[model samples]
Target: MGICSIKQMTTRKLLVLSTIHQISVLLLSDALTVSETSPDAPNSDDTTSINHPRNLATEALYINQNFRRMVLKRNEEPFKYDNPRLPFDEGDTDADSCVAYKYRSWYLGRQADGTEVRLICRTEHDGVTTGPNGETQMLTIKAFNEWDSRMASGVDWRSKLDTQKGAVLATELQNNSCKLAKWTLQALLAGSDQIKF
Candidate 1:
């Protein structure tokens, strides 16, 4: 019986060792190479630097208010900006009520040298805002890893807003991953004192 008990103890020791080995292997393989927020990702401060083009904002407001078909230009030349214009109408309500708005195409992408490049962008709202008591409704965005390197090199992101808006998102698409794009815009929008209606 003593010998049998000794054998059992040996087996238990082997089992525990195997378990530890397996866990260690898993941890080593699963070790994250990138930082928690992606090395290339834009942080909150990055978003504050982006502001909707004044012309684009005015166009959106005009469209939303006038209901006329007009092509919005980026006004910032070479930045090919074209997006669906919308506006906020408080009607007879106080001018302060004019906080409602919507984003038409705020993200875009492109391809270069077999790798994709993405652009972080967004349009503005002309209507009343919903979040804080007072805040500006602005478009927010971030570049995709696929296109991030190129975009960070100083290219105006909002070059095209209408039909080519998809290009902005497409240029930066890395195997169809949307996490970076979403995070970028969300971070940019986080600064608002109030959310748009």
Candidate 2:
């Protein structure tokens, strides 16, 4: 009777140990499977993973927002003239030949469908002048498609006049266009005040 009791106790211990071993094996296998299938897991065959479309779109949007902010900040600053004298300016051939000083500015705008757009304004002047100097300012306003990085289609306004009329028109267009663009960008970024009509 004593020998039988001892054998029974030994058998119970063996069973418990076996069960624990089996469970540990199962758990380790499951963990390995999960690690292998995870999205960030490294692949043995291919070193690089393809970028998901959603991720790409998100990255592009982030880039556009940053660009818009930079342009807006630059527009708020005052203009500076620091052009070095070029060899072409040294020749004295024509008296009426005016030195050209080019300036470019950008603004943010919104479309009818709640999409934000960027407007670039380029002006050329004969000398270092603030704002639009009469008879010497050539202005061109163009819309830029942020996503496409190309000039926005169906929106082009330009003026080339050497008179007070041109300056007035350019100033008016710049003020109106820049205001609209800046407002639109601000609204889009803040996700408030949707433009009506």
Candidate 3:
């Protein structure tokens, strides 16, 4: 009932209000995090399911196909290669007479949320040297996605061959044919919201 009691009451009220404000702020933060689905947002275990290799592969295919469609729609020509003996002459008979060639493809697509996705694939043919019967060769595949200036997931594979077999060397390339696709998908999903065309 005196001044000291009034001051004590005021101080208690202030402390309670502060505690309530802090609790509300924490709850609001949790709510925001749970609701956010953007690439930059923190993800729960469920959200991280997209990071699986299988999901990444599927995403890669989607991005590649979508990009191809975009290119075709724009009437643009994608890169192509048809010759087996390129960067080296068909008549080159030296043991080290190797010719290398690369083929690349790309596409662009917009996500449902309006994010732009870009995908690209590159295949390289190496050691194309002519022998007594035909040409010996090796192949490599590389692909990636670019969200704005940031390069996302990428994949690379090199061919394994027994060079001693010469022309008969049945080129045994460890064909990780899906590496590019997997990498592209990872990149697309990670940068979907952050990347700008």
Candidate 4:
């Protein structure tokens, strides 16, 4: 984001990005909104407080236990959750709304048509979604919290960023080169058709 937003985006890149955005937006999402006004809901006026880390985690658990549902196929089903509880995992289960685990395969192949094909991908994404009509698509949600700053540790971005736009951009190549490359690979491997950022 910092790199892409810092300088001019090519017309071809913009076209491709906007096209993907349009298509992903049209995907059938039975997505749950924080629509109801219950006793436990966050205050409407203090919007920023609602995005707090604690609130987000609580909200995820609330959704995953009952409302969260995703597509799961392939034999990777058996290895859903880890045998031992991971520090970042909560084994939330119980009810028919029990969210199923989806298995992502990383054993990607197909490099050549000569005799044999070989491709090695060390990382894989687990965000695949299947529509009601059996159209498989990967849905990725990319956020922009980092782009609001010049670097990972800088503050006062609102005031300083405007004056140092050129300097900030100059650092993009030095700091974000690998990050940009990784995002490109992720878009290609994880969501070929439904890539969005």
lDDT tens digits, residue span 70-94, model 3: 4232343322336544454567656
Backbone clash total for model 3 is: 2
Model 4 spans > 4 angstroms off: 1-137, 143-156, 160-174, 194-197
Query: Candidate 1, residues 1-197: lDDT per residue as tens digits?
Result: 35568789999899999999998777544331211233343332443342222322233334333431122222433221243223344364444312223343434455565555555434333222223655434423222222233323322355654557566554444322444444445544543332221
Residue-by-residue lDDT tens digits, candidate 2, 1-197? 45568788999899999999998767544321111222332223432322332333344435444443343333344333476333346565453322233444456677899887866443233222223434322222222212111112211233323345555444334434543465365444433322321
Pick by TM-score: 1 or 4, better one: 4
- Tell me the TM-score of model 1: 0.18
Instruction: Give me the candidate number with maximum TM-score.
Output: 4
lDDT of each: 0.38, 0.38, 0.37, 0.42
Q: How far does residue 180 in candidate 3 sit from its true spot (Å)?
A: 6.3
Please give the lDDT score at residue 86 for candidate 3: 47
In the range 1-197, model 4's lDDT, one tens digit per residue, is 35554235686687899999877555312222221222233233444665443344345444433322333344554233343233335565532223223334554455566454445443333345567888756553322122323223333446656898666544443444543455567666654444333
- What is the model-wide C-alpha lDDT for candidate 4? 0.42
Arranged by TM-score with the best first, the candidates are: 4, 3, 1, 2
Clashing pairs in 4: none
Positional deviation of 154 in candidate 4, in angstroms?
7.4
Supply candidate 3's per-residue lDDT for 96.
34
Best by lDDT: 4
